[model samples]
Target: MSAPAPHGPAFSGRVGWGSRPAVLVVDLCRAYTEPDGPFALPDPGPAVEATSALVEAARASGRPVVWTAVRYAAGLADGGLFVRKVPALAAFAEDAPGDWGALTLEPGPGEPVVVKQYASAFSGTSLAATLHAAGVDTVVVAGVSTSGCVRATATDALTAGFRPQVVRQACADRSATLHDTNLADLDAKYADVVDLPEALAHL
Candidate 1:
């Protein structure tokens, strides 16, 4: 890790990849990618393209790929507290039309899709069990909003006994400050913040 964040204790260590791994694509739905969508980030192109390449690489390597989306019913009853905190979540309503919450990545036939109501993909979802059942000890995580779902998923992945290797180029946020800050924290504590090529080679 670089020098300690100006205000926090120094953190420096690497949790190397395990023998078995899976790719966890977090919240790369149209709601976060489409230019005109309610939750769209500023210029999601780089993250989208990088993640697409990583997805293809993982598939070629026969690694399991898990995708996630934030989808709730029309009433927002399923969203609960999360919806209240970020009213923008209403854009992800499952009943919404015209790709408001469509998956940007083309999930393969056998790839499992996890629908989550919270920031962490493992929260209120069966992601940990699915990864465990598949013997996935390391998770190659990528996708949108590095400060939100990507960061949360990485933290939860660590808590669930999986190594989270976050690909920097494959994750993004509307603000560079949020993206970099979260990446620094994740690398310093919860996970390994790696480059796209490094993660692809591991796959």
Candidate 2:
């Protein structure tokens, strides 16, 4: 079998930072960070630290910081088909034990928390409107499961007319392969996959 052709030269357009940018911390809850949580990642320390730095930088610069977390009604009545697809989402149930859905990086004063039941933060949520109201033209993304929520949010951010800058070191997945491949694809098409320092500078 031959190797697949490279994605380069064609999808290589950069949607760099815009005049107004917001830092979006997606689903950095205990469910993914804690060892005993149902959806725990193998190593979330580095990603968490990187994300924390981004948050601090955004706050220091007076840039908006928005957070998203999955939360379902009792019995997951609001979870819809997504819960069936990923049963582990039960960890985010409103009444789940150990506060598994609690954000590991707590939002500061005046930061909005967007509760969602799906992967894409913009799906059925007011994220777009929130960003628009704040005059945010670019979204600096940092969070977990690179192949899932991070990818979904970045794609949707582009569709909603926001420049998506994904912080490479501020995201984690079940494995390194998933993290690297998804970032590569996102950088090629949907976003600019940047390092923590670049993201901080943008803030």
Candidate 3:
């Protein structure tokens, strides 16, 4: 079920390079993007491609391009609700082949990588301070599990006083229904939702 768009304040968009926006790519790791393989969530290929574009744009514009990965130590003991949500996630060992396997994007030069244990990147992490330090008042997010991590982060971003701009086509969940529905819900309430081209135009 695709979420229905809400009728509210029309957002023309207040985020762009002019405002020192940062692009946060969340969980594009193998644990969620592989096709129909283990730990896979829907098709994240398009999201990856779109995210890559955003990364390049952010880099070109001299803004922060941050990436986040969800990882536990090496055992379930380090994982709490994460262990309960999908016990299989514990398999993301140091470099062992688990779900979609390990994430590939290594932080290059200035890119800040945040490792988190929960759905919301803002939870128990220095993400807020980092964004503040970087003078980023708006966030452009793209990543996995639209209904979970993406939604949680967007909500947190809003509450934290940063404008959250979500790329509708740059995030995915395990189900098309879930991805679209969550996008609709986030669009109606929490974040600014727009397709890639429109987002780029506004930016």
Candidate 4:
């Protein structure tokens, strides 16, 4: 078995914050982060607005802004039973929020908009390499489905050698209780859970 990380969200263990921090918006696509859309989660409107502000701050500091969108090929062929099981996910039309309108923020000249299929942004995606190439050692994470995509991406970020800070107030899910519960877990185990003000305080 792999040894537990010597340091986690609870303590940095003397590893100071990174100089290059990026903003990673996970699964903010129209499918997940909307109210009346296919595969919509919950009240993701305010969360998206908060994320937009965070992106602005990251840009002001000249940090890379990475937005992750979820897209899978038609049929259960590309996504297997995962797609077959969630029939609503099949309705993600290219013209919908699945295209990520609310999640759209101008990437600085060299920023990235990563496309993904699964919950974890790092899964079958170039997120790790992209962040590394940008010299980003810390990621400010925000997104939809607090119990799903956000959690998955946060875990992957930590595994791939980046400090991931989950913006609790800037993330949402289908259930308010689920949102609060997942945020608690993320704070205790997966990632550092901080609200928008706390995140902006550090920035």
Clashes of each: 0, 0, 1, 2
Error of 3 at 153 (Å): 0.7
**Candidate 4: tens digits of C-alpha lDDT, residues 1-203:** 97776445454332235767788887676666555676576566788789888988887877778888766665534665666666566554344334543453445576678877677899998889888987888888988778888999988888998888888878888889999888877767667887798777666
Best by lDDT: 2
Q: Model 1: residues >4 Å from true position, as ranges?
A: 1-10
Candidate 2 TM-score, C-alpha based: 0.96
When superposed on Cα atoms, how far off is each prediction in RMSD?
Answer: 2.4, 2.8, 4.2, 5.5
- Candidate order, lDDT descending: 2, 1, 3, 4
Candidate 2 Cα lDDT to native? 0.93
lDDT of 1: 0.90
- Give me the runs in candidate 4 sitting further than 4 Å from their true place: 1-16, 93-109
Clashing pairs in 1: none
- The Cα local distance difference test for each model comes to 0.90, 0.93, 0.77, 0.75
Instruction: Kindly provide the TM-score of model 1 when superposed on the true structure, using C-alpha atoms.
Output: 0.93
TM-score, candidate number 4: 0.82
Which model is ahead, 1 or 3, in terms of lDDT? 1
C-alpha lDDT of residue 118 in model 1: 93
What tens digits encode model 2's per-residue C-alpha lDDT throughout 1-203? Answer: 97654774578589988999999999999989999888889999999999999999999999999999999998999999999999989878888778998999989999999999999999999999999999999999999879999999999999999999999999999999999999999998999999998888878
lDDT of 1 by residue, 72-118 (tens): 98778798988899988887776666667789878999999999989
Candidate 3 TM-score, true structure as reference: 0.85
